[model samples]
Target: MRTVVFDLDGTLVDTSGDLIAAGNACFRDMGLGDLLDPARDQKTAVRGARAMLRLGLERAGQLDDAVVDAQFQPLLDHYARAISTHTTLYPGAMAAVDALTADGYRVAICTNKPLGLTQQLLTALGIDGRFHAVLGADSTPTPKPHAGHLIATVQAAGGDMARCLLVGDTETDAKTAAAAGVPAVLVTFGPAGADMAALRPAALLDHFDDLPAVVRNLIG
Candidate 1:
């Protein structure tokens, strides 16, 4: 079957707010209140926990792996508790997924987020059933930007790697698609916004409403 793989954070949902809040929660634990700005650091937020933690620690002159490592789990704990508090699905996200499925495409999620947390967030959003598979950072020995990770996800979804495409919002996604020899469609609404075009993906998606057409053009 043809497959459509999506990145979790910035691709399908705006998870930056929750991610930033979690990082701030870690800072508060260290007696540093709100070290990261929600609006300004949104890009870093979607990059994952470590990036947010490192940015906060740097701002506080405490850039140490030990500090970040120690605070990492706490940050994840905080995020897991309030994963969807400020996270929201991008416009037409569900509709697009449905359209693809109706068109006989198998859809899946391949995220850099840990499997447990990814499942938690998707479940919280009440949309976990929408995907055929949800592969996360720890789902395999390797993660995004590695062909094996994406290829493994495709196989898990009962898809042919030759007939797969990736929809995402960052360079990581683009690189992963490239490594897997699949076409990549980068969303313009992500942290990098219109500038995501710099990554030179196979296509640039401005909205989920336009995704089905894009996927057809690329994969069919």
Candidate 2:
């Protein structure tokens, strides 16, 4: 059976609102103006928490490393406190996961989010037990776009590297799969914006239900 590795943020869930709220909280705490414009802020959400903090700090002209770090923890803490408040699975996400699981495909998560937070969000969303394994940014020595995490996930899932597939909504996921010698599918509904089209994934999916069909087409 082929192993399917998923990225948590954009691929599985629409987390931009929560991330923007966290970022805005951080900015507000520092007495800066709001930086949560959905059109502008959603793009940065795909880049991970540090990038989000940097964007907010840069916008506020407070990009000093110390200030960034100081704001980072609090923002993440706020996000954690409100993780499920505004987050939801994208359309068909749960169905797709259930379908994949019932089909005997090993499903796992390979995400850039911190380990504890990843677990918290997954559990809060009620999908934590669906994955055979969950690999977070800190779970490996290096995170996505580095290949180690993907390789480790495949191993944990008892899958053949050549038969494994990575599904995500960002360039980092594409790069990670490429480095690991696995094919990747890029979803169109994430925070990646135009960058998703440029990644040239093995396949592009506009809906989660299209995933199983894409996999069948690829492997068959």
Task: Give one digit per residue, the lDDT tens place, for model 1 in 1-220.
Answer: 9999999899999999999999998899899999999889989999999999999999999899998898889999999889999999999999999999999999999999999999999989999899999999999898998988899899999999989999999889999999999999999998877678888889999999999999999989
Error of 1 at 143 (Å): 0.6
Best by TM-score: 1
- Compose the digit string of candidate 2's lDDT tens values, residues 53-131: 8887787776888887777789889899898888889999889988988888888899999989999999898887888
User: How many clashes show up per model?
Assistant: 0, 0
After TM-score superposition, what is the CA distance of residue 165 in candidate 2 from its true location, in Å?
0.7
C-alpha lDDT of all candidate models, in order: 0.93, 0.85
- Model 1 clashing-pair count: 0
Minimal lDDT window, size 10, model 2: 33-42
